[model samples]
Target chain A: MQPLPKELLIEASGGDIGAFEKIYRATSDYVYTIALKVTGNRADAEEVAQDVFLKVFRKLGKFRFESSFTTWLYRITVNNAINASRKSTRRRSGQVEFNDNIEVADGRDRTREAIEKEQNEARVRSMLETLNPDQRACIVLREIEGMRYEEIAEVLQVNLNTVRSRLRRARETLCSRAQQERSIQ
Target chain B: MKCTEARELLASDFLDGELDKDARGEVVKHLDACDGCRRFEEAVRRAAVDPLRNAPRETAPPSLWLKVRLGIEHEQERGVRAALYRVWRSFHVPWTAYAAASATAAVIIAIAVLREPLTVPGSTRASLTDTEGLHEYIEEQFSILAYQDTNGTGNGANGNGADSVNFGTLLEEYLM
Candidate 1:
């Protein structure tokens, strides 16, 4: 993604609503995608996304443009999603139930594709659930978001070695689990 | 590198291209010589990619922007209310202090004004005795006292009213 315009960031920091709206339009999807992957549920993702943006709005004035806006946003998104995921877990106590009323077009092929897509999404979410929040975040950033190890470390506010260890452990667990499932099948 | 070290690198650093030059050379040399390390590398790569490739890219709901906008509005309102509360609190202490001081001053002024009635002599209180009325009242009281004394209406025969009047006249004269 391209960096946000400096003029727009300055204007937004000065309370220009129009400029802030433009900034939101540019980055909201990026924010939402991260939140969705981290939280693994649409409602929780949306809530996390809202909180991230609200925090961004409140703290924009303090941004000194030292890092790219996307990097700053990534940090905020990851932290908020982690917190939201933990809170959602505590609130639901491992018994999260999602509404299954997805709207689908009327056709057999379309219905099959939707079902496959939903199954794939559920499988991915379950795979992510095996790791702790920190490991999950590092894996999601590295694998899904395609961020570098250094970038992941910066966003997670940890050392590079920590990022490496977390990713290694996460991948090892996932590999063993996948093999186990394959053998079971 | 040992097979164990190569396997550990394959899990993350080798796949991610994060291994240092020397480490990468060592792991690559081991992978080339060991079938198990190659298989392990492939397995780890697959494991890392499978879930990420399958995970759907969900766009936020269309109403998400509206929700965010509403959230910003609510936050701004809360900020304004907080600021106003702070301003009110800042003034509250001084306003309370001023009110207490004003009440004390009013009490003092009231006491000073009311003290005149208590300190006035009884003869002076009976008439608005400025100058002429004061002189005439004093002379009339003295005459009444002398007449009562000469008539031998001494303490046994005279009523308490006459005794009181004489006493009042003497007290007023002494005060003057």
Candidate 2:
């Protein structure tokens, strides 16, 4: 359940620790989950989420109240996630290892639909893992988070056309690789 | 739109499509016949839906969150320290320049004050003085100007010969 005391955000901005704790409690899950998906590492994702929240706290004085606090929060979360993923890639290679003989880790195949769906999901994830962080971010925001192109542009601090291009390229790569994987399987 | 264009539209232009019946029929017709395009559509569906629709959503562990929060706190402290150092550095600059200027001025003023006594142009001392005394006086003035130019301002009473110039020249020589 979401909280209703919108005044808490204002108090938090004014350096009230208790108010900030409330804001944190209200929004931590949304921030952390997005960071985790983008970074694919708990350590990196948590760091990113923490940085995002800290920045939100520190820079809260600059907030205009022109946009919804939620949208501003979303922007902070997405930017940190993207930054975390970039750092992770530099520190450790994030390339997907395509193992043709890989078994399902879950080890459950109850029905044909279930088996196909599992296989498809695994293949998609592995292929997604191969993508550069930006493409992975775009895929996550557009397909997973269901964010619109304009919203994505705002989060990324990019143009609408760049978002569109990245989306097309990500989809094309995922689809092409997925097709090849399925044919091989 | 043509069948080829229709595939691109279906790719995700479908999300934006308030396509009327005619365009919908055209897209359906193309899909029914084009195996390549239909497979492409399925691929799109699979990619868009699989991880988002099927995979379990994972959240960060509590301990991990604590670690990150701690790291950010440390970073904030460091950032504040760095900002303070930068401000200190900015304050540091002018004081150094002032000290250098003070030291230079002091040296120049010492040279001017400690300067050799000039013979009054028409004094009984000059009448009594010989050629060697006048030559020594000129050499002494040379040494004083060199010292003041290197060290401080050489403004003084004996307004002639090598060392005699304005305050501006004294500063310029100091600069040079």
Kindly report which residue stretches of model 1 are placed more than 4 angstroms away from their true locations once superposed: A90-110, B20-26, B53-56, B89-101, B104-127, B130-176
Evaluated against the true structure, the overall lDDT of model 1 is 0.80
**Superposed Cα deviation of residue B48, candidate 1 (Å):** 2.4
- Candidates in order have lDDT scores of 0.80, 0.68
The residue-by-residue lDDT of candidate 2 on A32-51, one tens digit each, is: 76776677655677778778
- The sequence of per-residue lDDT tens digits that candidate 2 reaches over residues B1-176 is 46668666666545334357887778888888888888777778776545564555555466754654575568668978999999998778677889999999999999997675556675444632467766767787799888766555556524454455445565765874
Q: What lDDT does candidate 2 reach at residue B99?
A: 92
Query: Number of the top candidate by DockQ?
Result: 1
Clashing pairs in 1: none
Scored by lDDT, model 2 comes in at 0.68
Model 2 stretches astray by more than 4 angstroms: A1-5, A94-125, B15-29, B32-35, B68-176
Q: What's the CA error at residue A131 for candidate 2, in Å?
A: 2.2
CA shift of A136, model 1, Å: 0.4
